[model samples]
Each structure stands twice: as structure tokens, then as C-alpha cells.
Target chain A: MKGLLPRLIKRILGGIVMILVVASFTFFLIHLIPGNPVEAKLMQLETAGVTPLRAQIEVQAMYGFLPHQPLDIQYIHYIWQILHLNLGQSITYAGVSVTHLLLEAMPWTVITVTSGIIVSFVVGILTGVIIAVYRDRGISNALTLFSTFLHGIPQLILALLLAFLFTTIWPIFPFGSPYDAVLTPGFTLPFIGSLIWHAVLPVAAYAISSYGGWALTMKSSVISVLGDDFILASELRGLKPRIRIGYIARNAILPLFTTLTLSIGFMFGGSVFIEEIFDYRGLGYMLITAVGNLDYPLMAGSFLIITVAVIVANIIADFVYTAIDPRIRT
Target chain B: MSAKLTDRSQQDFGLSPEVACQVRDLNVTYRVDGRELSALREVSLDIRQGQITAVIGESGSGKSTLALALMNAVSSPGRIASGRVTYRGLGEVTGMRGEELRRIRGKAISMVFQASQNSMNPLTRIGAQLLDLARSHDLPNPRAVLREAGDLASRMSLDADRVLTSYQHQLSGGMRQRVGIIFGLVLKPEILLMDEPTTALDVLSQSSVLEIVRSIQRERQLTTVLITHDMGVVAELADRVVVLYAGRVVEEASTAELLRHPRHPYTRSLIQAIPRLTGDPGDAKALEGQPPSLASVPNQGCVFRERCPYRMDVCETILPSFRFDGDGEHRFACHYEEARHD
Candidate 1:
């Protein structure tokens, strides 16, 4: 226990340093984008035939967008607002706080992305194990060829193809939106079922696009691990084939865990086009709306969330490595 | 279990055999690009109980192929086409499923291969690996088994704690080979298959490992089949020697008898090639030319006819059969039996 305390403290400090770095970079990048929210709003008002001078005055009062204010003072104010959890109001959502809008959409994005990743991981790894065990066989060769072909195709193209088949030709799955208009957002079985039904096409698109890469990676890992001496030693030691394969797979799959975690973090950024295609009200949709309206606060908030998620996912992967492989614990 | 009972019944039908392992007409073929390349051709030998039987040959002479066939560890593209590898205790069980074969491996018959450094798990500690082996074989009281394993390590003149805790990557080649040998013998297996076990080690380490193996084999009365290309190792450890050339058993005799009077030209050349410690180095006769390729071997004669210095038309036309000398135990597959010399 005594030995563990210092290590735990060091890990906590490390995490804090990582989070701050992510947050600062996110702030700088958002600030670097061309045009501020107040300027865009003033430009919009002028386009609508409002007096330019009056529109400028109103925008200044709304956002404190003084042209002479020092950049450091503006950055200080931004940091203060973030510290207070004041994410500011969404321009497109009429008076909804950016935090509230993001919170409301979080569960839907999580549900689709998490389910897709989990299913793909399990199926892909199993198929890869089969391929590695039966290497050079007709079935393994066929799977390898097909997976390579699928992986070479762009994810967006795959999604569009899936949508064409499922939505246009089959007419089995709902085309867009995450729920029916009649079902309210309460804990009702019918509402949950409607949401799942609407999510099927997009989820399938995500899983199908990702599984080919995962399978290829896993198959290569299994093949390399099979070459390790321990595998042959285990066989010579009279271990059953099932047990031997399982032992090797456990060790071989370690790198995949790290890859999966990092990919999960990046999944938030990847959902933009898919969410738009499905018309889902997730953070990706919010990000698109913010970019369209030049809503700086909402855009900054979504970017910050994504950056933090990626860093945290990496840290989690490190922790998992120590847990699974004792050699890494030190 | 039923098969074991049947083997016991067979033993009861006849008196217990003196030989630990008997290979009768063993043939192994590898299908390379749809062509059957005979790796071992009608090889026959016997490993006596409580003695080391060395199969000495040059590279590509089917020494390792015989080892894999005996162990039933032949992978894809290579298979034991026809043979009876009958164990004295286990009886005749060939072409068994992997699971059934595994039941006999590491228990009744264990093996140590040439690449001992790569034969151990790098991720696992030595103690953990030993415990895994012990548990798999259902050794009683695993903690005690591990303790005994540690004791065994010390008995082999290794640092107990270091060997128990260190991974394979942390140890030297000699240390890993020592651990491998101990790993095989600790199970008290009836037969131990050693495939060029000392070939990868340095001279000092090689003799040390050989000494350890010799002492353990003597103490345990273990039957060992050692495969090597070195005649010196054959002289030191082998009670009986089987010489192979181009996948065929060219000669077989007691180590003393074969080393004294080699009948086949290949055997005679191999013995002559061994550099003497005291004799004039210039006088030693080294065998010239390489062994023939298995893919395009001749259909009608001895495989070694191309390489034999005293080859005749009869040697190229008719394959030689195994003929016993005056002593029935000493056998040679050569047309020129009259050319024998001591």
C-alpha cells in the first residue's frame, strides 16, 4: 500500500498535465479559426437589412467583442468562463446552453458508437483467429482477399452504399432520424425500440466500415504471435489446441486493446458525416450547426470535449496495459 | 485410457520388450508444390531401454525428420506416410488426433529441440512455466511440485531463485538449454527425444549440458534418442549409432562396432572425417560432394550412389537391402559388404 501511494499520485499528476495540454491546444485552434461569433452575427444582421451601425452595437453588447481589447484579456475571459462551466448559449438553438445541448445528445452518440465498436471488435477478432489458425487454406485466403478489398474502400463510400441498399432498395430500415415523431423522450419501451430501429442503418454502416481494418490487424497479430516459441512449447507440453490458442490470443490481442481505445476516442470526430447522413441529433450534428452559424462557443466546447476524450482514452489504455501484462506494471 | 489397457494386455501376451522404441519401415514424405518428396525412406532403428541411441547424419539427411515423425509433431505438407513407431510401454498408436497425441507428449515422451533459447516463453517466468507444465500433467500439490522444480534447478547447479524468476530472454543460450533439458527430464518421461540439443551451444556449455544429460539419464534409466551430425557426440553418449544418407538408413550397429569397422562407404567416410586429437590431421579423409536432392532422386538404385566414391553399376541399378554381418546385430545397407575395414 505504501509503495502504491506514490505511483497513484504520480499518475494523477500526469493525467492533469495531459488534460491541460489538450485543453490549451483546443482553445488555441478554436481561436485561430477565421471570424468570431459576434462579427458573424453582425454580418448576418446587415444582410437582413438591419442598420449596420445598430447591428454592430447590439453584437458588441451581446458578446463584448471590442476590437481594441488585448488578446491576453480575451483568453483570460474564455478560461474563466470555462472554469465556471459557462459554455455560453447556442446561437442555432435559440437560448439553449451549449452544455445542455451536448448533454442531451451524448447518450444517442454513445449508444450507436459504443455498440458498433463492441460488435465489430468481437466479430473481427474471432474471424482473425480463425484465419490465423487456418492460414493458407481456401477459406482464410478468401476472407483475407475480401477484407483487403473492403478496407481499401473509403468509409463514407461504404456508408453511402449501405444506405442505398438498406434505405432505397430494401426499405426495411428507417432512412433517417433517431426516433419517430410520435414517441416522446421518456423511459418507454416503444420509444427505446423506435430509437434502436432508426439507429440500425447508421450503426451497421459504422461497424462494417471499421471491422475490416480490425480483422486485418488482428489476423496479422495472431500470425506473429503464433510464431513465438511459447506457442510451440505449449503444444509440446501437451496443452489442448483450444487452450493453447486461447493463451496465445490473450497475449496477441493486447495491442488491439490499445488500438480500440484510441479509436473509440477518435470515434467522436468520425461521427460527423454519418450523423449528418442519418439526421441524428448528436454532438456531430451540433458541431456542424455551430460551424454553419459561426457559433464560436459551441464549436470550442465540442472540440474541447473530443480532445479530452482522446487523452483520457490513451491514459485508460496505459492503465489496461499494466493490468493485463505484469511485466509493464513496474 | 482403453488404449493403454489394451497395450498392457499386449505386453501381458508377450514378455516385456527390452527396447524402449522400435521404428519399423518408417517413411515420411513432404508434399512440396504437389510433388511428394520422401524425407525419410524406409528408416528402421531401435532405441534400447536406458540407453542413448544417436542418429548421426549430415544436413538434409533426414535426422530431424525422423525425430519429428517419432514425436508425431509433423505439421502441414509433411506426413508419416507409413510406419510403425511402437513404444514399448504405449504400444502402436499412429496417426492419432492432436489431442490424443498431446496426452502422451510431455508425460510419456518429452523432447528438447535445437533452438532451446526460443523454446521457452519470454513473457512468463521460469517458475510459472514449470508450474504450468506440472499442473497440466496433474502433478499432486502444485506448490510442492514447484518447490521440487526449484530443487531440481539447484541440483543441476543453477541459481534457484534466478532460474525460477527469470524469463527466457534474460538467460544465456546454455542456461536456457539446461532449463529445457531439466524441463523434459523432470517429468520422468520414459523416452526423451533430443534434436541437435547441443548444436547451438558453445563448446564449454555443450560439454556441461551433455554431462548433465548423461548423469540424469543414467540416474533415471531414461531412453534417449539423440539426433546430431557430430560423430564426437555420438562417441561420447550413443550406445548404438544409426547412420543416415539421403533419407535412408545406410548403416546401423553398436557405437563401438560401427566406429571400429564402418561397412558402408558413407559411414566409413563420416568416421574418417572426424578430426582426430592426436593423429596426423593431413591423413584424415574428408568426404567430398553434397547429398542428392530429394525431388529428382533416381527411381532404381541407392540414393547415395551419386556421392559414393566406390560406386559400381550394380549400386546404380539395384537398391541395397539391409544385410547382417557375422554378428546379426550389426547391419549395413551397402552393395560392397566385402569392402569393410577396421
Candidate 2:
């Protein structure tokens, strides 16, 4: 316990450093691009019939920094503002703060992708073990063929196909937005029910598309594990089929740990195509608009959040994997 | 040590050194790339009651295959084509299935595998794995079972508390092998098949493990089939020795008799290959050729003919059968056994 504490602390601190590096890199990269956010906002002011000089003054006053300011000074000011949790206003959505907008949309993307990943991971690993144990059986053969077919198809295409199938062809699920617009937002059961109801199509798309990869990995892992001497020993001990499978799965699941963590990290960035196809308002949906409009602060803020999520997830994976495998615990 | 076992086996079963398990012309074959490769070619041998029988052979001699065949656990591509593995009081094990096979395997026969590092799940604590085995066989009173495991560990000279709590990787190579041995014997099986148990151990650890095995075999009256390439191990621990060459039993005799007078050329070569402290180093002889691979086994004649120092013209065309002499206690599979013995 004592030794592990120092290692855990080091990992967490390293994760923070990674998040900071990602934030600074994205911030500088977006700013280094030819177009400026202020200039784009100035054009909006000019179209509203404001004089060029006054529009320039308005942009300077609103941003609290001139376009001609030195890059280092702007970076320092940006870092200062970031430390204060003030991500500045969004140039795309007038009068809205990037931080507030990101917070509002964070939950939707988090819930959808996390739930989808969990669903896929659980179902894929279970089915993969089944397929491995029954590799020669007809049913598993059919499943392997289907999963291979699913794995080859791109996720975006799968999402769009599923959306069209469920929303237009079958008319079984709700089409657009995370929830009904008419419903009052609170902690009510109906509101949460409506929210989940609307999220079905997009979540299912993510899960079904991601399931193939996890299942294939698990099948291969289990197949290799089946050849191990411990497995034979377990069988020789007269262990029931279920208990033997449990032992096999426990060992086989180790290699999949890193993959699962990275996928969870990717979830924070969310699935943009799924969000866009279903018109579900989430970080991925916001990211597309931010990119199109070239909202620097908004884009960088969301990227920072996603990068942090991924880094923290990876750290958790390292610790959890070490905990699970005694060979690595030392 | 062996005389006591022999006398007891005769007195108890009254069949004169009663057979614990009999392998009746068990033929195990492997199909590789559409070709049938014979791994064990119509091999028949007996594991005697309350006696240690050492299956001594070089690699690829199908000694390990013989062990797996006894347990009915030949993996994919390998099939027991035709033969019977008869376990006394349990009937035939070759075609046995379901609860009958399970029951036989559970409390009747257990095997300790080679490569001790891989024989245990590294993620599980040793105690938990032992407990799991107990639970799997529906052994009642879990607490009592675990206590017995600890006692067994202590008997093997392992620290009971530390060994039970630690994972496999936490133990040294020899310790893990001991744990594997203990686990194999936890159910008190009638037949214990130990496949090269001390192959990877240091001299001290090997002797220690050998001592533990000897004591256990005596205490429980176990019918142990010990597989080894080491003639020294065979001499030290086995009561009876069966020499296999290219998937066939070349010689089977009492250990003392075989050590004193090895009939087959291959068996003589194996005995000569063993290094001795008392003998001059230059006296050690290395066998000339590799053991025949399963894929390239000769279609006719004695498999050892290619490397036999005393190869005869008839050895190239005909396979040898077991030739018994003097009360049929010692047998050698060689056409010129009479010439060689005389």
C-alpha cells in the first residue's frame, strides 16, 4: 500500500502535465492558423452596418487584447484566463460563454458514449468467449461471420444506416435532439425517460459499430488462452464449464484493458457523425459548429476536456490493469 | 523401498503386483497437413499399484503423449485412433464420457504437468486455486479442505501461510513445482502422473522434491507414473523403468535389473549418456542422431534402426516385438535380444 501510493501520485501528476501540454498545443495550433476569431466577429459587426474603425475598437474591447499583440503575451493571457476557468465567449454563439456551453453539452456526450462503450464492451467480450469456446459450432461460426462483416463497415456509415432504418423505415425511435422540446427540464422521471428514449438510436449505433472490434479481440484472446496449460489444469481438476470459462475470461481480458481505456477517453470527444445524423446536441455536435465557425477558444476548450479525459482514463487503466494481473503488481 | 511396495501390492490385490492402470496397445496419432503422423505407435505398458514407474525417453519419444493419453486429454489434431486405457475398478477411460469420466478424473487420477510456471494461473492465489479445485469436485467443508492444503504445503517444506497467500509468480521455480505436486494430490487420487516434475530444478531442489514425492507415494500408496529424460532421476526415484524410443517401448524391467543390465542398444546409450560423479568424464557417451520426428517416422522396421550401433540386416524390414525371458519379469523389444543377452 505504501509503495503503491507514491506510484499512483506520480501517475496522476503526469496525467495533469499531459492535459496541460495538450491544452497549450491545441491553443497555439488553432491561434497560429491564418484567420482570427476577432476578424470573423468583425465581419459580423460590419454586416450589421458598423464602421470599420468602431468594429475594430469593439473587437479589441470585447477580447481585451489587440490582434497585433505579441504571441507570447497572448499565450500568457490565455493561460491566465484558463487557470481562472474563464474560456472567453464563443464567437459563434453571441453572449454565450464557451465554458458554460461545454458544460451544458458535456453530460449528453458523456452519457451516450460511456453507456455505449460499456454496452459494447460487456456484450462483445461475453459473445467473444462464447465464440472461442464454440469455435467449431455452427452458431458461433455464424456470429463470427456477422461480427467480421460488422467490423469491416465504417462506424459513420453504420450510424447513418441505423438512423435511417430505425427512424424512417421502422419509425420505432425518436429522430432529433436529446429529448422532447416541449418537456420541462428537471429531475422528473418522464423527462429522464424522454431523454433516454431519444438517445436510443444514436447510442445503439455507437454500440453496434464498436461491438465488432471488442468481440474479435476477445475471441482471439480466449482462443490463445485456451491453449495455456493452466486451462488444461483447470479442466483436469474437474471444474464445471462455467467456472472454467470464468478462469479463462479473467486471464484473457488483461490485453483488452488498454483498448477499453483509450475508447473511453475517445468518448469524451464523442462521436461527431452520430450526433450530427441524429441532431443530438452534444460536445461532438458543438465541436462541428465550432470548427466550421473557427471558434478558437471553444474548439481548444473542448479539445482540452477531451484530452484530459483520455489522459486520466489511461492512468486509471494502468492502475486497474496492474491490480487485476498479479504478475504486473510488482 | 520398492520391495515393500511390491509385497503390499501382491498382498492387497492378490494378483501379484496388481496393475493400477493398463495401457492396451494405445495408438495415438496426430494429423498434420492431411498426413497421419504416428506419435505413439501401438504402445502398451502398465502402471503398477503402489509403485513408481518411470517412463524414460528423450524428447519426441511420445512419453508426454502417453501421459495425456492416459488422462484422455490429447489436444486438437491429435487423436487416440485405436486402443484402450483401462483404469482398474473404473473400467475403460478411453471412450468414457460425462459424469463417469469426470468422477474418474476427479478422485481417481490426477497429473502434475511439466513447465510448472505455466501449470498454474498466475493471477490466482495458490490457496484460492486449491480451494477452487476442492469446490469443483464438491468436496464438503471448505475450511477443512484449506487447512489440509496448508498442512500439505508444510509437509512439502513450503511455508504454509506465505505459500497459500502468494500467487504463483511469487514463488521460486522449485516451490511452484512443489505446489503443483501438492495440488495434483489434494484429492488423494489413486494414480498420480508426474510429467518431468524436476526437469527445471537445481540439484538441491530436485533432491528435495524427489524426497517429498517418495514420502508422499509411500504414505498414500500412490501409483505414480514419472516421466523423465534423466536416467539419474529414474535410478533415484523409480522402482520400475520403461524405456521408450521413437514412440515404442524399447525395454521394461525392474529398475535395479535395467540399471545393471540394459538389453536394448538405445537403453544402453541412454544410461551411458548420464554423467556420473564417480566415473571419468571421458566415459560419457552422446547418442549420434536425433529422435525421429512424428512426421518422418519410418514406415517399416525398428524405429531405432537408423541409429542402432548393432543394427542387423533384418532390422531394416521388420519391427520388433517384446521378447520375454526368465519368468517374463524383464522384457526387451529387439530381434537379437538372445544374441545380445548371451
Candidate 3:
């Protein structure tokens, strides 16, 4: 107990240090891509009768950074902005701050990722335990086979297939935005309904693509727990089926939680694919545009969010795991 | 005294013919790969009231199957095919099912599993598990059950508070075994079946735990069935010993008499296998040949013929019927006796 605060401090310090390293790496690595956003924009402005030097100045002015500066100085500048919680302006989104753009787009991703995770985790663990309890049954074997098949399908393929099927063939659900453009955005029923309606496909893609893995992992975990001596002893102790199954699920669900949290960060990264495919205007979609336009601030900002998220989720998993499993509490 | 129990000799030996549980022709079978294998065939024995009856057998012997059968708990593909476990107060245990069976499991005939270290729910504290058991049996005062558990632990020379508060892993193996006993006895059940209680413990822990079991059994006058392969354990605790060979009870006698004059060839070999420091080193002959597995037991003859030193021609085909001793407390099944032996 005396070491708890120190341990927490060490963990949070490690996370911060990791985020800084990732930021510097992202900043420098993107710069190594040959031409800067200024160079890319300069060509377009050059054809508009602007001088080469003027075009460079205009593009630099847009993001408010000297693109020609040395790598170390720019790294220091990026770190300084990060320390101030200010990710500089987006070169592509012109006049918008990278922080603002991310904040605006984060919700859509959060909604889909969180919904996908909750649905999949609940369904996955539920199915995992059910199949494990009835492991010898034909239904369990068939369900297990189905889960394996679904889990093997790549996320990209799943997303693309979902997008094609729903938007092209069914056309019942809308695409290209988080909600209907006709309705004014508020706490209105129509707005929320459309929001949920739009999320179905992307969320489906995430839930379908990843739930199989959760179910399979959870299945093995549950099966092992079922075979444990305590389970038989529980029966000998005359523990009710409800109590027995609850204990089984409790122990079996422990390992999957770490995977669940770690997936949150990966879900953010996955947003680049799902959000783009569904045209959901989430952080991932903005990141794609930032990469295409070579928007240094926005790209660096997106990568930073992902790195920090993963690090934070990992830290949470470590703490949560220790809390849940008494054997590992110390 | 009643004519049935008029023999004070049996009473003086701390046992009686008053059977607490009469396992009559219990046949438990396990079906593996579509083939039914006999785990326990015609395993009959009397667990006398207030007597520790040790079922001694090799690993493959159906000691555990008989113990579980007392609770009427044979898992799927393995079941009590046809049997009547007439538990004195509870009537036929084999006839009970579902809720009726579940309710009496801990409250009437509790079981302390083999290597009880693994028998505890790892996630919960010892107290919580006790409360869970109490709740299941619908015991009104769960707090009293917890107190009784603490008291039981304290009496058994454990730190009661620490033991109750701690999880299963936190407790030592010996402590966990003791805790397992507490779970069984907390409901104050008349019958306590301990399956190899000391198997997973060190020699020191084993003795201490054995002493605890001995003291507890007397304190509550529990009708116990200690299932173990170790003859030393059988010598130490059992008032009566039932020697099981390949799922069949080959001999049943008072522990003293059985150890002194083991009539069955299998029982003789088992007793001989026990190493003693005082005896010549070569005098201890390790029993040759494996104990018959569930699938390998002969269908038409004596199960111990393969491992018996005195193998005869008649032993090959016809099964031997049980023959009684002068005391009638001693009974054995073997074709070749040579004489009355002792």
C-alpha cells in the first residue's frame, strides 16, 4: 500500500514520456516524407500566378509555422505546443486548429467505437460462456465454427462489404455523414435517431470484424474455468447454477478486459478505415485527408492522440487487472 | 442393548453394525469413445455411524467414484447405473435428484474433495464462500455460519480472522485443506466424505491435517469416509478399512484386523508394499503390474488375478464370492486362501 502512489506516479510518468517520444517520432518521421505541405501547395499556387517564395509563405502562414526550420527546432516547437495542449493549425482544413478539428471529429468515432465495443464485448462474452457451458452440444460446435469464420475475415473487407451491401443494395440507411443534413443538429429525436441510423453500418463492421476474436478468446477462457476444481467443488458445496455460472463468467471475463481496453486505442486507429468507408467525418477520416494534403499539424495531432490513447488504455488495463484478480493484487 | 448391536466387541472397537450409509451394488460407468467403461462395479460397503471408514485403493481403483456416489454425483457419460445408497437418515441417496439432492449435498452429506487447495473459488474470500454455501442450503443465519467457520478454523489451530478474510491462494495448502473441511462441516452434516485429504500436502502438513480431521470427527462424531491409497493414512485414521481393487471391494474389515491379516491377495500385496524402516530393505516388495483401468478390468473373473502372487487355474474364469471370517466383521473375496491363513 505504501508503494501504491509511487507505482501510479511511475506508470503515469512512463505514459507521458512515451507520448513525448511518439510525438517527436511522428513529427520527424513525417518531415522525412521528402516534400512538405508548403511544397505541395506551392505548385498549386504557382500555377495561379503566385511567386514560388510567395506560395511558400502563404502555405506556411496558413499553418503558422516555418516549414523550412531545422528538424530539432520544429520538434521543440511541436513539444512546446503539446505541453500547452495546443496542436497547431491544420494546413488542409485551413484556418482551423488541429485540436479543434480533432475535438469536432472525435465524438463520431467514440460513438461507433464504444457502441461497437459494448455490443461485441457483451455478445462475445455471453456467447463464449454459453458455448462453453454447452461445449459438447452440436449448437456450441456450430457456433464456435461460425465465430472462427467471422473472426478470420479482415476488418477492411468487413467494412467494405457492409458499406456496399447497405448503401448500394439495401439503401435503407444513409451514408457520407453522421446524420441527415436536412435536420438541424440538437437534442431532437430525429437528430439522435439519424445519428444512430448512420452509425449502424460502421458499428456493425467493427462489432462483426472483432466480436469473433473476443468470443473465441472468451470461449477458451470460460472452458478452462469450467474445468477448474473449484467448479466441481462448487457443485459439491451445493452452489446454485446461477451462482456457479456467475463465478465462471467473472473469472473468465478477466483476461478479455485487457484486450477490450487495448482495443479502444486500436479502435481509434481503425476509425481511419471505418469512418472513411462510411463517410462518418470522424478523426480517422480527417487523418486520411490530413495525410493526403500533407497537413503536418493535423497528422501529427492524430498520431499523438492514438499513441496517448493506447498508452492510457494500457495503463488502465494494468490497474484494472490488478484490482479484479486478487492473486495479482500486490 | 439391542440384539443387533449386542456385540460389545465391535462397540469397544469404536464401530458398530449400525450402517450410516449402505452402498449396495453400486455400478458407476463412464462412456468414452462410445464404449462404456465400468468405473465402479458392484462396489458395496457399509459406512458405520460415527466411524471413519477408509476406502483404501490404488490410483485407478474406484475410491473417488464410491465417495462421489455417496453424494449421488456422477457427471455426464458416467453415472450411478443401478444402485441404492441407503443413507441412514436420508433414505436412498441414489433416488434423490435435482433440488432435493442439491439441498442435502452440503447440509446432509458434505464432501471434502481431494487436494482441496483447488476446491475453493479463487476470486472469493473463505468467509464469502462459506456464506455462499450457507445461502445455497437456505440456512437462515449466514452470519452464524461464518462465525461457526471462524470457530472451526480457530479450533483447528489457524488464524481465524486472517483465514476468513484471505483468498484461497493466500492460504497455505494445509490451511486450504482445513478450510475445505470447514466448508464440509460448517453445515454440521452427519456424514463427511474426505477424498485423499492429505495427498497434496507435505508430510508435516499431512500429519497435522490428519490430527485435525481426527479431533474434528470425534468432536462432532462425524460418520466419515476417508478415501486414500496410502496405507499409512489408513493405519492412522480408519477404524474400518475397505480394500478396493479395480472398482470392486475385495475385502472389508476392521483396520487393525485388515492390517494384521489381509486375506485377499490384493490386500496382502498392498499391505506388503508399505515400506518400513525397521524391516529389511529388500523385504518391501513393490507391487508389480498396473492397477486395472476402467476399460481393462476383466468382465468374467477376479480383477486382481493379473497382479496376484497366488494365481490359480480357477481364478482365470469364475469370479470369487465373498467369504466371512469367524468374527463376521472380516470378509474377503479370493479363490486361493491356501487354508484359513491366520
TM-score of chain B of each: 0.93, 0.93, 0.92
Task: Pick out the ten consecutive residues of candidate 2 chain A with the lowest summed lDDT.
Answer: A59-68
CAPRI band for model 2: medium
Question: Individual DockQ of the candidates?
Answer: 0.45, 0.58, 0.62
What total of clashing residue pairs does each candidate reach?
0, 0, 0
Give one digit per residue, the lDDT tens place, for model 2 in A1-330: 247999999998888778778867976685667776666777889899999888877665445444666878867766777777777777788768788998988788878887898898999998898899899899899989888988788878988898888889998999887889999989999999999998888788888888999999999999999989889887776777777877898999999997898788655544777898888888888888888877766787778777766777688788899889888876
Candidate 3: true interface contacts recovered = 0.67
Q: Candidate 1: which stretches are off by over 4 Å?
A: A1-67, A76-88, A134-153, A161-198, A227-229, A326-330, B1-16, B122-125, B138-144, B165-167, B272-286, B296-298, B340-342
lDDT: worst 10-residue window of model 3 chain B: B7-16
TM-score of chain A of each: 0.86, 0.90, 0.89
Kindly give the stretch of ten consecutive residues in candidate 1 chain B with the minimal lDDT sum.
B7-16
Model 2 pairs in collision: none
Please give the ranking of all candidate structures by DockQ, highest first, separated by commas.
Answer: 3, 2, 1
DockQ of 2: 0.58
Candidate 3 per-residue C-alpha lDDT over A1-330 given as tens digits, one digit per residue, 9 for 90 to 100: 247678889999999999999987876676677765545666778899999788767765544445677766766766877898788778777878788888888788778888998898999988888788888899999989999999999898999999899899989778888888899989999999999999999999889988998889999999898889999899888888788887888889988887887788777778899888988888789889888877777888888876776787788778888777888864
Specify the highest-TM-score model's number: 3
Q: In terms of TM-score, which candidate is stronger, 1 or 3?
A: 3
Ranking by lDDT: 3, 2, 1
Q: Between 1 and 3, whose DockQ is larger?
A: 3
Deviation of model 1 at B215, angstroms: 1.4
Candidate No. with top DockQ: 3
